[model samples]
Target: MSKVLIIFIKNPVAGKVKTRLAATVGDTTAVEVYKNLLHHTQNITHLMAADKFLFYADFLQREDEWPNEQFIKHLQKGNDLGKRMHHALEQVFLNKYKNVLIIGSDCFELTAAIIEEAYLVLEDKNIVIGPAKNDGCYLLGMKNPQPCLFKNVSWSTSQVLQQTISICTREHLNDCLLPTLTDIDDENDLSVEQKIYFKLKKSAQ
Candidate 1:
């Protein structure tokens, strides 16, 4: 089946991204961390064979790591996170793709292999979800737009994953769950080896 991968990201703007992390490490450091996360996402997703789309929070950037010709870039629509996501899915589904998956850049552990596996699972199931350790989901995949799954969601809370599953159950949509991974949100969320906050201290000055 034809597949599409949607990646949601913000252009690395200091004081504008990762607000929680910014609170702990300051805006300049948060921007750097987000930049690193975006780089990691680009590297991991570069090898995938499916059609890829980068949904930007603001305007598009052509000079970034993701070559303009390689991934289709679009600005995210709607007023809230859930609405934006639902709109993207609706638009993609209207285009007649057989399988679609959306992921955020927050999960550093996400890999191309896991993404491929989600697409594979979509061959049988209508939905595939990768649960995050924070009770939020890292990745969500589906064959068609199921708008109910995106509604009434408590974004950024510990109940996100559970609420999504409950909606799925209510709708009787067949689904498969992937392994859980941690998404960086707070300063404590970063692994010691990945700590590059020190690098931003000088720039912030």
Candidate 2:
């Protein structure tokens, strides 16, 4: 079974990435912070044993200078947030990966071990979710593509996680929830980045 990691990212342009954080930290700093988050995610994903890693970006044609060899970069398709994620997952599964996991670039606490755990959970569970502290989800995994869970989801809101769970229940899909995690979306979430940075800095010494 091939394990796949799909990272949904945005062009870390000023005033584009981390809009909420931008309000607090200024657009330039927010973009820098967002870039750090993306780097963190890329580093962790590279440490995993996945057969394929897909970096799906919002703007298809806008090419920023990211590390090319880090992952397979692809432009995200679909109208809304939910649809884009669904489309990306569907394409990856259609291409023949057995276990696929999708994640965002904002979770500073995401580690190789957590990703490995999600892959393991997918061995027995149809759907796996790593819930976020803000009532959203940082990671979602599946044995195969299931579009229903991503359909009609209220994206960018507190109801996201609940709506996903509701969809799972409505469709009778076997689901597993991993330990709660945090994503850097607002001013409060900035602490997560500091903590991760300091932890890594200490470990490096």
Candidate 3:
């Protein structure tokens, strides 16, 4: 089956990305952290078997770290997070892809293996979700477009996963749950290695 991996990312701009993490670490540091996360995401998805799509939040970037030759790029549509995600899925499904998965650039622990598992599980399931430990889901996949899953969700809140699950149950969609992972949102979520890296980054600045 043909599969597509949709990556949603914001253009790394100081004071714009990672606002919650920026509350503790300065804006510059937050941008730096976001850039690192972007690199990590690029590393994991660049070589994956599925057709990759890079969905930017604001505008299309013609030239950047993400090799244009490998990824099909587009701008994310709609106003809120849920609407944007739903729109992305709608677009991909319209293109006749058999399986589609969407991920954001916040989860450092999200690996290519996990992403592959998501696509693999869709072979028999209607949907797959990778829950972020607290904030929300890091990854979501489906074989067909399910608009209900994205509606009525409070984005960026702890209730996001539960709300999505409830929707799945209500819609009777057979869904598979992936391993819970961490999303780098709060200052407390930083790992020891990340802390050291940030410290050194500051020292070098």
| CA-RMSD of model 3 | 0.9
* Residue 52 miss distance in model 3 (angstroms): 0.7
lDDT of 1 by residue, 20-88 (tens): 988977898888888889999999987688889899998888778898777988889988888989988
- As for candidate 3, its clashing pairs are none
Q: In candidate 3, what are the lDDT values of residues 90-145, reduced to their tens digit? A: 88888899789999999899999999999889999999999998949999999888
Name the 10 consecutive residues with the lowest summed lDDT in model 3. Answer: 148-157
Model 3, which residues run further than 4 Å from truth? none
**Best model number under lDDT:** 3
Poorest 10 consecutive residues of model 1 by lDDT?
195-204
* lDDT scores in order: 0.88, 0.81, 0.92
* Candidate 2 Cα misplacement greater than 4 A, ranges: 60-67, 192-205
TM value for model 2: 0.88
